[model samples]
Target: MMRTPAPRLRTYLSGYVLSLVLTVAAYLLVTHPSYSTSLIVGLISALAVVQFLVQLVFFLHISAERKPRWKLMVFIFMVGIVLIIVVGSIWIMNNLNYRMTPQQINTYLNNQGGGF
Candidate 1:
């Protein structure tokens, strides 16, 4: 009986350890108050994205050989579009909400009351 090589096992173990570390870091980032909530959330989001890519490439083997590169590119492009739309909508809505004047608010309230 020949012994099987362990390169794949080593790679999988390393990837698992890195994933665990990333998970812990994300948890800590969300729980700690030393940093601003926005900053911590941004950092955690970035880290999560990086970790997801790492897992895809290292553990899932999502390469040209396993699947077509075009499929991966399309997936990434779709995700980018979704992120842009969501972030843009939030930013636009926040600005609109913050910039409402007292007069505008009163006018809306009056309109709602049938101009009473």
Candidate 2:
């Protein structure tokens, strides 16, 4: 039987440091907003994903071990959930952006000779 090595202090420290850096980056992106909205959104999303992986691998020990298939399935399910959430959010925001405001709605109502 092969003995698996346990996680060391350095691994945890690295993950912690990376998470801090990513958090700081997200804060800076929100505070500065120097880049385009789309660009900023993409960067923040990417950073969040990287941090998630880092925490999973380093802290949660999501690596090759017993029940590898189970781990893979869980990871797949999590990815699917994240995809659904991100896609749904983007879709909703896109639709809201294209929707007419109250002013436009009033103008339309006046033109159509309808008010309620």
Q: Pick by TM-score: which candidate is best?
A: 1
Local distance difference test values of all predictions, in order: 0.77, 0.85
Give lDDT tens digits, candidate 1, residues 1-116: 21322236766777788889999999987776679888998999998988888787568655523333665787789989998999999999999989997688889889898432
Off by over 4 Å in 1: 1-11, 36-38, 64-68, 101-103, 112-116
**Model 1, global lDDT:** 0.77
Q: Considering every candidate listed, which one attains the maximal lDDT?
A: 2
TM-scores for candidates 1 onward, in order: 0.66, 0.65
Quantify how close model 1 is to the true structure by its C-alpha RMSD in Å: 5.8
| lDDT (Cα, 0-100) at 34 in candidate 2 | 97
Give the C-alpha miss distance for residue 6 in model 2, angstroms: 2.3
